[model samples]
Target: MKTVLIAGFNGSMGQQAVKLVNSMEGFAITAGLAHHLPDSDPTSYGLPASTQLFTSLNEIPAGIADIWLDFTVPTAVYANVKYALTHGYRPVVGTTGLTDDQEVELKKLTQDNHLGGLIASNFGMSAVLLMKFAQEAAKYFPDVEIIEMHHEDKKDAPSGTALNTAKLISKNRPAHQTAPDETESLAGSRGGDYEGIKLHAVRLPGYVAHEQVLFGGAGEALTIRQDSFDRKSFMSGVKVALEQVHTLDQLVVGLEQIL
Candidate 1:
């Protein structure tokens, strides 16, 4: 069985990962690391009696687990992933907010160490498919815009899925593709612009993670959308990453590669 460590084990996504790994075979959780945990026993989250939980990464001993599954927030993600790599733990990161430069550096470090790591923006299968679909559609429709909606509690604006979609579609489109001339009376009404595509973000209650890619042509428009109504939607992708990360020779940044 492969040993596992969970980061952010108390959050909704973390809890889901915890439950999933517990139910699956050929995997075992050795420890869980959260910012803090309430006064309770480990089994409360279905952890085995041998498993432990910690609030700080430093508190854990080295070589405690073979790999780490990170569901932490963006601000803390860089340091957490670096710690895992430096300490010889392969990491499967579902955290968002890593910049392009951070990704490049992480890949180099993983290669240098002769290890494997996975950093994914969205772990929902439909979301990954949406990104691929948008890239394919961009070859035909050059003018596109994106709108992403997530729960208000999500800290990052312009969800990682949306950013990845824009980047993929941007690469397929020609340079200097222009949108129609328009005027915005309000300062931020047009949303953020990446390449030539407009991106809008929405945060509200009662939403999990959702995105829509709208492509406009002369007389018709095509919209490709995906909705994740629950946190469990991502568990499958996380499981896939965990099972497949060790097979890589370097860091991977998207779930689409494994799928």
Candidate 2:
């Protein structure tokens, strides 16, 4: 069995990871790491009594887990994954705020350690497909924009999926301005720009996770959209990563790599 260590165990996605690991046949929870916990009692968090719980990175014993599954916040995720890699744990990261330089550093660490790791921006199949489709559409239609919506509590703007979509679209679409230079009556109304692609981020109480890629060509327009109604939609992709991560020799970004 592959022993798993879950970081940010108290958060929503972290709790989902806990459930998914427990339900999988060949995976077991070895420990949980959180930035802070009221009590050390494992039962309080619905974890097994034998599973070790740690509130600090330094306190986690090395060699306790084979895989480090991270769902921590943007602020803590980079450090958490770095600690895991240095301590001999394979990282399967779902947390999305890691900067490009941070990822490059982590990739170097993985190579030096000869370890396997994955950092996925979105772990939902629909979201993954949407990015793929958006990349394909960009080749034909260079004029495109993206809008991503998530729950209000999400810590990052221009959700990782949206940013990743823009990166993918940039790969196929050349660098060129799609819209004319116009001043907005209100400042900051055009959304963020990524290599000429306009990316709009929406955060509201009722939304789960959704994205729309709009493309305009000539007199016609095309829109591709995807929605993740529940967090469970991501677990399947996580499971796939867990089962296949060991096959890789270096850290790679995107769920599409494994798929």
Number of the top-ranking candidate, with lDDT as the measure: 2
- Which ranges of candidate 2 are over 4 A from the true structure? 175-178
lDDT of each: 0.89, 0.92
How many angstroms is residue 26 displaced in model 1 relative to the true structure, after the best TM-score fit? 1.1
Across residues 141-231, which tens digit of lDDT does each residue of candidate 2 receive?
8999999999999999889999999999999996555578979999879999988889999999989999999998889999999999999
TM-scores, in order shown?
Answer: 0.95, 0.97
Clashing pairs in 1: none
Question: Which 10 consecutive residues of model 1 have the lowest summed lDDT?
Answer: 173-182
**Tens digit of per-residue lDDT, candidate 1, span 1-259:** 8999999888888899999999889999998888867845788877887888888878888789999899989898988888888888999999899999988888888987888989888999999999999999998889899999999999898888899999999888854367677788998899998877899999999999999999988899999999999999899998899999889889988998878
What is the lDDT, from 0 to 100, of the residue 34 in candidate 1?
A: 84
lDDT of candidate 2 vs native? 0.92
